[model samples]
Target: MEPVTTHSNHDEPAAASPIWPWVVIETLTSPDETTVVLDGASPRAFSRLNRTSVARASATAARMLGPLVAECASMSKPRDKYFPLRDDQLRRMMTIPVLGPSGHVHAVAVWVGGVEEPLPRTPIIGAIEWSVKGLAVANPAAQYLFRAPQGDLLTGHTIPEMLAAFDIWPDRPGFLSLFNLENLDVAADQWSGTATLHYDNPTDTHELFIAARAVGTGPNRVVRAVVTDITGTQNPGHADLTLVAVRAMPITPGHAVALADLKTGFIHEWLTSSPSSPLAAWRHHNPEFDDNSKLDVVQTCFALATGVRDTATHEVRVRFDPADDWIPLLAKWTLIGGGDRPQALIDVTPLAPISAPMVTGCRMCQDMANRNNAPHQ
Candidate 1:
C-alpha cells in the first residue's frame, strides 16, 4: 500500500496530470449497520500529507478523507469527480468501493487521478487474474487449488488446463456463467456462482464457488476471481441433471445412412432453451456450439427428412477438420400421417466406434453414478 503519487500545485494544470492526492478509507460496520468504526487508512499520515483538519486525523485514521466518502457512498459505484481548485487547476478523483465476500463494503478507495496497480491481494484467499487469453496470475491459494507450483505465475494457462482432471458438469457454458461479466456493475455486483466439475479419475468431484470482478477499464480489463472449493458443503440436490439424460440415451452404431438427401446430413432445429442432448462428441472436439445446438441440428435435419419420406434414417459425421476426430450420430425420423400439422417423431443417438470405450455419457459423471449406486454392506 504505497501512497498515491503527489504533484506540485505550482501553476501546473492537474487536470492533465496523472498523479494526484488519494486515500483509502477503511471501516468496520456494526452488525446492525447502524455504526461505522473507522479502522484505519492505508498510506499512513493521510491528513498530514494533504494538510487537512487536525480533528480529521483520528488515532486510527483520517475520518472520511474529505467529501469523496459521502459522494462515493451516494452514487454506489466507481466514478470520476472533477474539482476546480482556487488556481483553476481541475483535479479528478475516482472512488472504488472494496467489498467483502458477503457483499459488505469494507473500504472506499479514492484515487486522485488513475489507478496505478491492481487491488491489494488477500494472500490467504484463492485469487486469480483471468482474461479471454487465459489465466494471468494465480495466488498462493489459487495455485494450491489448481495444482500449480507455489511460486509459479499462471501465464497462458486455460481454464481447461487448470482443471484438466475434471469434466465441467452440465457442459462448459453452465460453468463459464460463473465468470461472466454481464451482471458486473459494482464491486458488490460481481459475477459469482458455484460450478461443479466431476473429476475424471476415480475420485470425488468438486464444486467451485467463484466470485469474479472486472478490474481495470476498456480493453485492458481483466477478471479478478476468488475461488473456493465447496465440494463438501454443496447440497446433493444440486447434482447435474444432464448426467441423467446422458445415461438414458445410450450410443449405438448406425445400421445405415438413408437420409443423406437432407442438406448438411444433419437435422436443424431453431430451439434455444432445449435441455442439452447427450452428445459425447463435443467434449473432445470443443465445438463452437453447445450440446443443445448440436441436438437442434439433429432435430432440424429430422424435420426436413420427414417432410418428404414416411420414414428416414441418417448417419451424421460431425468434424470441424478432416484430420480431427469426428463424432457420428444416427437420427431416425418418422412421419405420422393423419396428423393435424405433419406431426413427426425423431430419435437421435451417438454412433459408437468399433472396440472403443463408451462415449455416450460423461465418463466422470457416470463413474460417480456407478459408485453411488453400488450397494453398501
Candidate 2:
C-alpha cells in the first residue's frame, strides 16, 4: 500500500479554489463496476460539498477518464499530487496519465469504461515500385510496348473503329496510318476530309454550297459543306412577302429608292392596259366632281402613286389600302430587286376637266386647274 497524496496543506491555507481531480474508484458494493469521480476540493472542501455532490450522485453522471484528465490538466495540476495510488490498483484501474513533459503529471485518470485496445500493424507495398520494375525490364518485341495501338480506355475502341461506328469512312487515300512497338512505344497518324449535311422542312427545297477550303490531301477531298431551302420561286401564288419584307427597304437616300422612282419603272405596266403609256382621261375622274375639280384630279393622281393624300388643310395622310388604283402600277414596275426611277413621268395620265373651285392660291387646286385649263401651256 502506498501513501495517498492529497491536494491540501494547512500552511498554504488549502487554496480554497475548487480543484477537479480525475480518479477511477472501485466500489466495494460492486467490485466489477468501476465508477469515475470528479472530486472537487478547495482549501475548505466542505463549503461547496453539496453542489459538487450532485455530479457524483448517479452511475451515468460520473465523469469519464478522458474529460476528467482534460479538466485536471487545464488546471495545471500534477497527477501524482492529486491522484496517488498503488501500482497494482492503478493496473486494475486502467488509468492512463494525460502526460506533459518528463513525468510531470498534468492529469491522473483511468477509463470509467474498458480501455481501448491497440490496433495491429499492417504492411503495405505501394504501386510505384511495381510500375518502376515493369518499366525497367519490359521487352519491346515480345510485349509490343510502344507499338500497341492507342485507343479509348473505357470503350477499348480505336479511332478508326469509332469513326466507323458513326458511319464516317475516309475518302482520301493515305488518310489513316498506324505504328506498333513491342515493349512500350507506339504511334498512329490520321487525316480526313470534313463535310456536314442538313435537311430543311416545310419548303421542301434543297440547296447545297461549298462551305470551307478543301480538306484532306488531293483533288477529290471534301472541304466544307452547307445546305439551305431554295423554295422561293417554286410556288406560283405564294409570294412569301410578309409585311416585314415590304418594310425592310430603308427610306434613307443612299440605302433606299423612293416610291416616285418605283412608279417610273415597269410598275406602271401592270396598273394600265397599255404597258408603254399612262392612264386615260375618263379613268382619271374624281368621285366627288361631276366635272372633276383640279384639286380632285391632282389629289387622285398623287393618291394613286404614293398611297397618300393631301388634305384640304395641306396635311398629308397615308393611304393604306392594298386595292388602290395606283398600287397595281407601283407593284408591277417595282419588281422585288429593281432599282430606283423617276416619279412624275412613270405613270402620267391626261388631265381631266375641272369645274367648281377656281382658287389659284392652293397648290392642289392650282395643279388640278392647270391640268384642266392649260393643256398646251
Q: TM-scores of all models?
A: 0.32, 0.11
**lDDT by residue (tens digit), candidate 1, 1-377:** 22323334322333454333334443223111111211122122112323422113221112324444554544556655444333544444555655443343444555543334333432123556655333445655556555553445454444534544334433333334323332221122135455555544447666665545554554555555555565665442343343334324433333221112132221211111122222322222222334655665556544543454476566655543344456666657655332212323345555765212223343433443455456998
lDDT of 2: 0.23
Best lDDT among the predictions, by candidate number: 1
Candidate 2 per-residue lDDT over residues 1-377, each given as its tens digit: 12323333211211233222323221111222222222321111112222333234312222232334443444434221122122212111133333221222222333221112232221110000001101111111111211122331211212222222211122211222211111212212222132122223334332211111122332223211111112231222222232123324333221212222123111111123321221211122221222234344344344444435322222121111222222111211222332121232222222232222222233333454556455573
For candidate 1, the per-residue lDDT at 370 reads 55
Computed on alpha carbons, the lDDT of every model, listed in order, comes to 0.41, 0.23
| Overall local distance difference test of candidate 1 | 0.41
Residue 130 CA displacement from its true place in model 1, Å: 9.0
Worst 10 residues of 1 by lDDT: 266-275
Q: Candidate 1: how many backbone clashes?
A: 4
Q: Model 2: which ten-residue window has the lowest total lDDT?
A: 125-134
RMSD to truth, every model: 16.1, 41.3
